[model samples]
Target: MHPLDALDAAAHLAATDPAAAISSLPWLSASLADDAAAGRFARWGRSSVIDENVGAAVLPRPLFDELHARAGLEAAWPVGNAGLLHVYGYLLSTTPTPYGLKRERWLTGDLERACGLAVAALLPWIGAETLLSRATSAASALLARPDALTEEAEGRTARIALGAPLPDGTAALAYAVDGLIVTMFPVADPAAVRAGLGAPRLRWNAA
Candidate 1:
């Protein structure tokens, strides 16, 4: 099945059965428990690493380990190579923040710094397309709303795409856009859906 079609199916499940939707993600299926995933996302909504001085995002270590394992990366990537910083940056950018902390802080502070560092470190080995795809997929899972195809979501997706070193951001944008479109419009068979939509026009810095 096309990735977007898969996302549509996931979103359809999310409408009535959010747990099923989350569990349907291929990358997340093995290690992450459904209840645990929900709880962890809830913690992300309630907690803040800013006031806590935790140095890392409030996400649990085991969850982070699972994400890395799914990505086929070494454990040392998170701590030694600053992969956690990249994860934190993606989360801060895509996920909603608590009221007290300024979104600007996350946008301008360690979030951007960490993302840049992550791009520099990972791009050489993984290439930009894979890096952005995995990062965005992980972020989409963390947000627990893979169906959010809003302008803001698209913008966040664009930021992630632009962070990579791809020769052209077109494919990256298409992947993100297609994911959003599928989530927003969950049809069992996407051939008709894709025919209706024509093709997703690259909306983010296609140049």
Candidate 2:
């Protein structure tokens, strides 16, 4: 499917069932991407983003207003960390082996489903990636002495231009969810997703 189409479909899922979307990765990313394209963060920015892109309203009319409102503000419109973790638990709630990461058994024709499922799973990662890209771009621009950078700041913006944190080695599940969702759904943050299965309610044991 076309990338945007995939995103729209995922958004449809999210608009229909946000709780289910959070449980899956693919849906999360798609929904986030759609929402990001809209004017969710337009307020932070100096532009009207929502109206510019009508795709944000693809989902059922019921959620358009609320989602748009959420996006308008800089608040975490999409489910928060705990909600995301709750869904992640079900998606990766399978048996835990020596490795901490739980593995899922892929079924036939599940690639698309898996991709859909990964929307939520990978949004955090994708958001981090975007932040990294922006930071790198900003840093590069700063190093290049762009108009945005003035001598008054002494390139401090460039110095603090670290990209969003990625879940490379640490328990960056929060960041991971954002990055992973974007990776799959192709959206930014504060967006929603959908999944068929609910995340399992497994208890965590301390070491």
Clashes of each: 0, 40
Compared with the true structure, model 2 gives a TM-score of 0.24
The candidate that wins on lDDT is 1
Predicted candidate 2 versus true structure: per-residue lDDT over 117-189, tens digit per residue: 3333233224434322322232233233222211112221111111222233111111111112111111122
Weakest 10 consecutive residues of candidate 1 by summed lDDT: 178-187
Clashing pairs in 1: none
Off by over 4 Å in 1: 1-23, 26-57, 76-207
> TM-score per candidate, in order?
0.24, 0.24
Alpha-carbon deviation at 35 in model 1, angstroms: 27
Q: Model-by-model lDDT, in order? A: 0.32, 0.27
Query: Local error of candidate 1 at 71, Å?
Result: 2.2
> Lowest summed-lDDT stretch of 10 residues in model 2?
178-187
